[model samples]
Target chain A: MNQSMVKVFDIQKDDFISAGEASSSVKKILKQLGVSPEVIKRAVISMYEAEMNAVIHGGGGKGYAEFFKEHIEIIIEDNGPGIENIELAMQEGYSTAPGNIREMGFGAGMGLPNIKKHSDQLEIKSEVGKGTTLKITINF
Target chain B: MEEFINSVTLDKDKCKGCTNCIKTCPTEAIRVRNGKAYIIKERCIDCGECIRVCPHHAKKAVADKLEMIGNYQKAIALPAPSFYGQFPSEYSRKKLLIALKNIGFDGVFEVAAGAELVSAETEKRLQTENFKKPMISSACPAVVRLIQMRFPGLIDNILKLESPMQISAVMARKLFSEKFGISENELGIFFISPCAAKVTAVKSPIGIKKSAVNGVIPISEIYGLVHESLKNTEDDNQTNIFSSDIGVGWAGSGGESNALSSGKTLAVDGIQNIIKVFEQIENDKIENVVFIEALSCPEGCLGGPLAVENRYVAKSRLKQHMEEAKSEKAQIKPVLSKAITWSEPIFPSSVLKLDDDVMIALGKIEQIEKIEKDLPGLDCGACGAPNCKALAEDIVRGIAKETDCVFKLRERVRQLASEMIELESELPHTMNRTEKNEN
Candidate 1:
């Protein structure tokens, strides 16, 4: 079978209305590429949630997703306030976001946890003053 | 499965082509293109928010027509427990059953009976430590799909129980087929539905792939038929269709909780209410709140858009009916062994793919970084996406380009200030020459 895949995205922060836009587009590309629904859904959920974090908490960031024959990879990086404690942040319901964010329907602290749950491999690196970067890979 | 079960339909005539739905949809499910609105099947949660807000009434929930039931020799009406709230207090369960029969149903089965079974199964499952914390209710198929799309991580938490309608349909069909020697095709079970999600559930069921029920009859159409019949059969109480407790009290929000078991469970009516509970659950604040019952419809199923009476009125009437025909004891009988065996498991079909390898994904991130450096941070959806990062993801997906975003492009232009200056210095001295000639 011929394997054809090419897709890219750039994520920006504070875009509430279009927070999941890139994820949806990636989902569309995966569908067109005929990726299995299971793999596509996981990648979309993980990537989308990450993208939301970048927007809501990352101050602003960029997300790049790639579709390959054996897997899907997503990288999100931002210059926003970086994580102070990676381990504590990974815990569910440990959000530092202000209450206003909660009103907008986010900051339940499920972002990183959900990312870990859906992805085959996940990694996060951050500098408190510099920014945070998240990388997720899903194997088909 | 009916191939074209079209659970949701848009009235092209009424659609004004507004992108309101496209913008508001949590899943980006609706796409406005070619001057009309279309639901991208893979993305829609069928929350019925569209159905609720459409100014033109363009969005309609596609359900079974009453006339179609004629195809079956024997048809059973499996009314949702929410249906109890649709009539007045004076209305009798016997009359309601008679009304269904009067409208041509061979028999009527209370879905609350099915709910009773599900409540028991859920209670048993909740006692296990292995069960995912804060298990989600499967009764609302829309909620199930929402998790599948947006919160796949929480998918494990979704209760594996078959919906009440599915169970009742299975039982009702088995009983009818075995006793009367009727062919499965001749026995039709129709769910009097409250929402579009139920219609979709019947079409592409979750835990159980194929639905036992054949068709869905919207509650709105059946309400008038039942109402008119009740007035006609005012004096005659001959039809003992719904066995008291099985029929009445099923409509109100907490009725199911009350019927299932009074203690150690919680029932939340309406999507907003459920969302609040979910937030609490996420905080790990709601403990011992086992077997949370969530109804997408406010006031429980009684508030279904297709239901006959106002939700408040229906709720009151339902309470009165339950009081009038109170069941002395809650039936905890084991579900019939033949009730749908857990056979087919619904697995999510994967669709996400990485556009490149790990290194390539890294490379794209670098490019995204460069692009982010040059773009404005405003996440205004004016660029057609929800925000700048979403726009970046769109770039990676090839669905959109960085240039598609006006703010990004403007920032890019601003960032090239040095080049702009160099170009200005080298620009044809046309302006200078023109000025000299004028002087």
Candidate 2:
């Protein structure tokens, strides 16, 4: 049976007040679907890291979540300066965020690494001059 | 399934179907359905937030009556530590104990003594157990229920010890029965509760199959009687219970953490704040803490809805009482029994589930999301739900309709108007054809 539900959210750059809104909505949907707490927690942490990256690194972005029978996939696409090197970005404590962002206690350089650690699978596609898209999948 | 009994009840006669209670409930256990606020038994934690917020006095905590003491040959009053903070500082601890006797209890047992024992037991467990850090206190029944419903991951962190109320009831029953040579059935152990959650705890205990206390009586119900008895009597015979000031401090916030020696602890009161802290803990944000004392009520048990005194006043009075009684210490040592420890694993209540089946719940979520898109998202609470999302859920559940929202109704009216205009234009063409045929 093809049982799937999809929801999309538009996230704006530097929108500090609503930075976590998308992740919260995703968590709420997962909870309503009666997902286990462990799965929800993993999904939340992965999605939040991706959401923050979209807002902080990318100028503005769109967050999409597709809930399926076996797994949930989250896609974050952003129109900002793309990553020059994916391998370097994935390293822990490696961040290009400005000092101001670091002072806000957010850009500790663990976003991508933490996301990879929590999600079952992570995919990163980016063109240096174009934009970046992160696809995260977490199994139920 | 056994019928679920909740201590918080609604007075239908006084209910105006207001959304205040629904909004205030942390668990979203209350819903305005059929023009009345209904409590979902599985979702309700019996925190009594609705009872405190309702303006019409519709919400009430159902507890045992004072007259029920007549049912037993010997009645023991197991007063919660918070109960001591309800009265004025002029009333001595001996006077309070005597007043309880005058009010119909054969003997008085201080729950603080049990709190002292539990504190000592918890200290020992912290040193011996190799479990998770930041162990949670299970003294507040409301907090335990909240964890069961929302924070199931932290269930293992909750201390498996019985609450001070239960321990006090057991001690009281044993001491009273032995003194009078009466059977357990003939003696009643009643807890003087500071909140509705305690009443529910006594009725249907968590972790344990049954409660040690026979019944629970709200502090508000017996406050007036205790005061009257205090005024009528003279301080001739003085009786002192076996509870130190440290144990009595458990009545207010931070008391449990303070009672424990040499550990990094965090104490949080109020349901919303506790939820935030729990979320942080789940995210691995909080660390280096040995214990966490989370209370559902603001300022701890003193802020319970069933209490007679204001929370701030009670807290100050309790502080003063603690300061004055610092020299006195508990003379009795309680023996901790193995039966009081929880042996079974705690399970999640899963009250947040939309449906029992995952597929059905997923389908419902799609419908709710579709409905939510059309909603104005104003969260005005005009539709009798706490928010637009809740209204969308209610709509999908067939309890509400799209037209219930004013914005949706306006959109429907606009569509009908456009359809009427199209029919009106067609009417002119039909009239011309009829005129030509007649000619």
Candidate 3:
């Protein structure tokens, strides 16, 4: 919430190699900040996978990150075809990624599950055709 | 334990300070500082991803050399079960042992025997006390360290059995000293490592006081010697070379699964694959899975860092060796028992902590919030963290500060832009003189 040190990133869809780029930068920052390994790991996993989802399914997205002494917060917003069924998406091994993606070793249907697993707190906002936004926080 | 000395090293000059490894690292063990790479020893799992990806080959693996064994009176070679995968089809076990002796080693022992022993011990432990569900294999030292750092919660799942190499080294020393009437200090044991993590493991063993292994010989360096031995059957290979199918099979993934003969076990290869399985376990999703075998490298020990052949080639060679294993029943019991000792419990160490105190964690949280307000939230590595909040924590640790990132300064510039606009409107006449002076 502090006005001074807020960070922002613009993520693109289908940029596979660059999908986790923003999250990587975030993780580096967290480490230099001397955040506990546990908290930084959680924050990185949540943010990176979420960013990947935006690129893979949401078409493209934007990321916002805020650092606190004890917590790291991340927000991802995408203006793509949003989730039609959040419950189905949450299920393990229920991936909607194309076969090509699977062949590349991703789209295991564990993306959302992984994001949720790593975040201390996670919130998702999506509409079928409108867009989606994800907010994740990890307390150190 | 050797106090968890991280054997993995960083050659800073070659690092481009890119965040590639930082992003890919499962444990966030890598950090780019002052335009080079730095590894946090406490957090590194020695998984070798950075070594695999470093463009400049800056992330080199550190291991003991074969020459180091010369310092001892008697040098012994303890080849891992994966060692068989390095040779050609004609490379006989006796020939390999003979060549090891020729290479100045007094004796050669298969690490598979130790693995067999540990496997038996692990089996017994499973039937007893109510342990963490889906007990993890302790053979892979990298995996053990991974649990120590990132997945400390999963430490309960780590089987308490000592690594086969460790057990083998101890046994080799004991048996050789007893037969030869030599002092223990005069005997040297060198593990032919499949990967760098194993080398690190022996140098700094976990759950034990001192390492039995005095040095490590990377499999890659010894491959040529083994190949040469196979070509020259002219030398007498009269020395007895011992091992079994179950023991040798420990070289590849699913070898452990086959050894345990557990119907509910799952074998996952590659560090990334293991990470995925670990996540599933953390979620408690795979409930029926009783045992999990995780290899840091793909295709198990054959895919270790010190290996010479590709994983596929090594796998085929390993398979061929398994099929050729002598199946006499009488040879089974003694070899199985003598090759390994699965009696001792490999207990998990308590490394994971939720927090020293909830109040302290809370206070740190509040400070991070205040720091965030001062940050520009660019999530730039210039500040050395992923985002503003992380920068705040860095400030707490005294590693980084708010102004380290250029984005925050840009925000300040933008904020000042509006103020200058308002000042121009208020004092247009005063600006005219200063503007004329500049012209």
Instruction: Output the number of the DockQ-best candidate.
Output: 2
Give lDDT tens digits, candidate 2, residues B200-230: 8878778777888988999999999999998
TM-score on alpha carbons, each prediction = 0.66, 0.88, 0.68
lDDT by residue (B1-439, candidate 1, tens digit) is 1233436678899998765555655556565546688776766767776776677778888888998788899888888866766776666665676676677888777776676676667666667787875666677777677656544545666787787788878777876787568987789899998778888888877777689889988999788887787777653443333324533454666665565453767888766566657544533346576666677677767777567688888777777767766753433232354224345665443323234353454455445556666557676555565456656755776766777677667767887987788887775766668668878
Give the winner by DockQ: 2 or 3.
2
Off by over 4 Å in 3: A1-140, B1-4, B228-230, B233-237, B326-355, B366-396, B403-439
Ranking by TM-score: 2, 3, 1
Query: How accurate locally is residue A106 in candidate 1, as Cα lDDT from 0 to 100?
Result: 80
What DockQ results for candidate 1? 0.06
Q: Rank the candidates by DockQ, best first.
A: 2, 1, 3
List clash counts for every candidate, in order.
Answer: 38, 0, 39
Colliding pairs, model 2: none
What is the lDDT for B434 in model 3?
77
Q: Best candidate per TM-score, number?
A: 2
Off by over 4 Å in 2: A12-16, A53-60, A77-110, A125-132, B127-129, B232-238, B337-339, B406-439
lDDT of 3 by residue, A19-130 (tens): 6768766754554444555565577777877887888888897999886656768999999888899888888889989898778766778888888888888898999898
DockQ of each: 0.06, 0.49, 0.05
